[model samples]
Target: MAFKIFHPISFIFLIFILLAPLGHAKRSTPSDKTSSAFDFIKKLKGCHKGNHTKEIHELKAYLEKFGYLKYENKSQATDDDFDDILESAVKTYQENYHIKPSGIVDDATISQMTTSRCGNPDIANGTNFMQPHGNKHESGSSNIHTVSHYTFLPGNPKWPPTKTHLTFRFSPNYPVSSVAPVARAFHKWDLATHFTFAQVGANQNSDMIIEFHRRDHGDGSPFDGPGAVIAHAFPPTDGRFHYDGDERWSIGSVAGAYDLETVAIHEIGHLLGLGHSSVGEAIMFPSISSGQVKNLHPDDIQGIRALYGR
Candidate 1:
């Protein structure tokens, strides 16, 4: 009886050993594969060497997918290991979203990563719609504004030259004090192109409508509040510009403030039918550094010119 029991027990132990590898394989799959980016980010906070590597890899892929990082060779597999490339990409992403460029995964960076954003991509190199040009830096401004790479919206759409004067109105919710900055934003674009903006009181019969909205303010493209997206504008004839009211907005150099003019210039570029550009200095770039004032880049000027001749 003892010998028979030992044989059965040994057989069960052998089966367990054979299945253990399969179980380990399942468990060894990176947590990033099974969790949301946010969950992965939560793990990255203050993570050390030999830790959170899976999350780092996931973030590198995210930035690369969104045009923040460029891979030299398409055939090369993305390294699962966290390296300098991944760290730099994280820093660049942080700056774009106005988070301090700590070069480490931080809460602010993670939050921006998880926030819902404009469907538009920050870069469009592969699309035929983009009119690629070598970057040119203009002379004599504190910051050069050149049209580096000009890309267009679907169909390369632009407002008809005949419709040179565009009318606009502030959503009742827009602070009256903010009108000056909005007008300034419009002026910056107007100087670059043939179009002009007129701010009217009525929302109807306006070429563009500007408003400050908080979560789900209708129009299907809802604001995600303060950090992720400061504002978004409709392309071409749509003429809807919305700002995330939850942002800590300021006109000038205020610590931890989102520069209103800089954001407006970007959104207005969208309203004028410009898509995001890969050029870091271009106002049309999808993200902004906090409190950093931007001037138009040649890429921006060239874009508008390509659409509507200067």
Candidate 2:
């Protein structure tokens, strides 16, 4: 059964959540990946009404694709107008994410929507990828909640103890500051698990190769520049971590700014063979936000301990 340990979100920016593509058809042009809806929403003089505008239609599509909005017909045409259904969806999303639940598509909401994030799917192929480890149960009941704090990739395989000192090196093109957060990210996992990360020179052979690249950097998972995928990592025993070079990565705590350290920590969790958790507070949680300082939750500690016996 999946166990949960909830905590109030304490970040300056609540958190950025991941959005799934309705379908995966790679865009050939940069313009194709950028959404004008955010621009339009910002220009609105007041709250939009239930009139079908191109921007409203885009908003509907965005909300619906991300599990906030639900309608009777998937094939139905968008009127581009705000309605009670859309309002409710916006409010629900706001409340769930700890944003102010004003049913209007305000600047804060648009900013959150436009923020880039990791490419990992929170729910893939209609399946909750994070499955319970079948260890814990609720008190006074045999029924177990179908959830997880963290999950493994397909095989649940882990690195052997013999592979303790893993070497990593970053691409030389990125700023030196980028490497600092990555080292910190690795340190966090090192403290949690039985392994240690060794930073090596660029010419040295390494187990993990970290790079910053824009769209179509030779991987099947091409990053959409800005406002979409911020980074991704290969699972354990095969370590290739990529961050979107197009993103405005920073180490600051300024609200609405993406923190490199936060994302690196998440990608390292993936590199350590952890999957997305349904538990929102977990370091392995599928999403993150700009200006957020993420620490390993107890659930995250429990998960790594379960996997590596640390």
- Any idea how many clashes model 2 has? 8
Angstrom error of the Cα, residue 84, model 2: value is 20
* lDDT per residue (tens digit) for residues 1-310 in model 2: 0001111323421231112111121222222334422345554324544645556766776565544565786544276667778777777655544568888767777665665556764444444455445565576757665444577665665777788789999765444445777899889888888888899998778989888877787988777656466789988888899887665556645344467778888888778777777566777765565556787777777777777886
Tell me, what's the RMSD of every candidate? 19.9, 12.7
TM per prediction? 0.61, 0.63
Off by over 4 Å in 1: 1-119, 123-147
lDDT of 2 at 262: 81
Best by TM-score: 2
Compared with the true structure, all predictions reach lDDT values of 0.64, 0.65
Q: Enumerate residue pairs that collide in model 2.
A: 1-134, 16-289, 50-82, 51-80, 51-81, 52-79, 52-80, 53-80
Top lDDT model: 2
Task: List candidate 2 stretches off by more than 4 Å.
Answer: 1-115, 124-126, 131-134, 137-148
